[model samples]
Target: MKYIAPPRDAVDPQVFSRMPLAAWRDHAGLIEGRDWPSIEALNAHLPAAARECFVAQTRELLADGLHYERRIAERGEIATRERNWHDLFNALVWLRHPALKRALNARQAAEVARMGPKTRSRAQCALTHFDEAGVIVVASDPALIAPWDAHDWHRLFWRERTAWQDGRAQLEVFGHALLEHALTPGKLLVGKALVFHSTQAMEVVLAHAAAAIAHGELLCDPLELRPLPLSGLPGWHPHSDDEAFHRHAACYQPRRTGRSYPPAVRLGHLGRAALV
Candidate 1:
């Protein structure tokens, strides 16, 4: 089913309390009591580190004739549509993860320059996928990735559910679209993840992911990303706690024939498989 965002006035403030939107609740809280924020208001929320690449109203960028990514790369301006949930969530992601957002913008702008704004490369597709639905999954145990790679939702999400709460595995939502989708009640959210093996703090892993992306060492191909059914994550959905849910949920997709994922990105000084 296609996701159609509700009007700003129609969105329920309670949706932000959901697990999938947990990472964004702090930013989303800013708008719960007021009308949708204007582009200028969105810019005001940007942290000092992100002040250089500020949010610009979409209309203003349309007249500039620069490609969206290129504008951010060259002029440090992110084109954002006011009152739109998608763009609003995007701005929030920018506020929370400036380095990662900047890295994605840099890579995208580089692709635009190389492939021409009229065309797109495989790398661009992967970059866009991550930007829209990406999750940074850090795992302390390499064994945890087996079920995920095999698309075994039952084993990965149910059998190993404890990993989610014990800090053995953690998911940081990077895709604004996922946050946007959570606005709909009972919507099933899935994330494209770049799993890494490490024991480093989430912030350190995120920094590594950003650096890797900016340096063109990651997201070179769409196949490199792994699918993760977000609903299966503990506390993400009401039914997920039941073993039957993992077995019968619509989101549980079987592994495709001949499909195999590449190894997780292994960071230096690893105590276990980690994330970025």
Candidate 2:
């Protein structure tokens, strides 16, 4: 199939937040299980600025998912839950391309044959199951298959496309092995960390966390993470270490026996407590 380039300079951060969740989900489904147009083909269809936007967005999304997974794994309570989350996100990433989805059917046998005696016997043994069930087959429409003409599509389209590409590259570089290992029980032991402690924090925090995790650093302590509250949301406090304070506020489960519970510790407070 031919590749079409999305419009140039079409990214809008607000679109991601304001677009209806259902629309995003539907668009995701449409693109999932498809292969991306080759870089050369994309260049033909889109302007340089648009192409750059696509690349930037792709990198952002991939980095976001990777960091999120790492943080979740660090918590130590829910391996299965984390695995499921990882699987779903990974599948979503895979599904971003129709070609990849279709190719998954024959890629396994082909991969094994290509590897031959040089193949890791363990890897061959593992892929047997994925070759059978996990690869999904979905019908494709001609419009979906056509190249992106960069007409009047929404800005979010470019953003989503960029994010998907970046996420896929990350999977190829760092997460490919992780995908194989995570597929089976005991295949691997992946750690998780809770990266976002509060939704109330600035959007820049996500960018910062993504950067740190991409470079293999700890973004924050998992136990202390929480979502920052949106303005006008109940219990929103303007002057707190929002992430830490909200985490403490939300996680305040009463003890079965009534003794005074310690005050919620802010992220900044952790150092003082350590020194004490």
Candidate 3:
């Protein structure tokens, strides 16, 4: 029912990492008590000056609940509005998937309910901030997922591009922030993923991450930017291992350790590893 701006330093660096939504991290501080209302009721709650920011183009965004794909197609462009970063992001998240935000909040609230507000146990902390740190991609078939746990992101994401190209795999980034909150914790949320296939190949994720440590920037050039799909993501594969991933051959190769964190501290009933 209430949200608070976690301190910038306190904000988990790993949270929102590499994800397009990561752009919203800095704006979190601006919207204290982050309880956002439904899109149908959101505008009435905004300040008069802030209300004017929506403009004619985003009337649908402000007035109704539409999935991101539908709203973007209807608006016929990237449906973005810059209302101080927080509101813009709030609107975007709601626009993209209203269910996700609601589900994430409900799940977090349930965790708080179970663990008690003041006590952030390791599991409690992980579950509470699951949206930012945890990511999982669910595909249609078990065969399509084999490469993930085998640490074969190259095949699962890149070499296997044909799977996505043909639209056979049917990947969906789970609205688990809703799925988990509902506690139907299934096989989909079992493990972690390298990156969603739909994500753009932005070097800044690696650039920023690369800048933080020695030799990390060498992992990927800041200049090369485009959606390389699976190969574009950093740390998904052991690019540094030349026998496996040769740098001269890659269009966008990022060399980094191939290690992924679990989607949850404890998956509860969903014990299997997801993307691995």
TM-score ranking, best first: 1, 3, 2
TM-score for candidate 3: 0.37
- Candidate 1 ranges beyond 4 A from true positions: 49-60, 269-276
TM-score of each: 0.92, 0.21, 0.37
Best by lDDT: 1
Q: Which candidate number would show the highest TM-score if scored against the true structure?
A: 1
Give the lDDT of residue 43 in candidate 2. 30
lDDT of 3 by residue, 109-177 (tens): 444566665665454343333333233343334465455444454665556655654544432232223
Task: Report how far residue 128 has shifted in candidate 1, in Å.
Answer: 0.2
Candidate 2, RMSD to the unseen true structure: 21.2
Q: Give the clash count for model 1.
A: 5
Question: How would you encode candidate 1's per-residue C-alpha lDDT over 1-276 as one tens digit per residue?
Answer: 678988777877777777877566566655565577777777677666654554656565588899989888888877777677788788888888888988888889989999998999999999999999999999988999888888888888888999998999987989989988888877778899999888888888898888888877888999989888999988898788889999989887888999999888778733322332
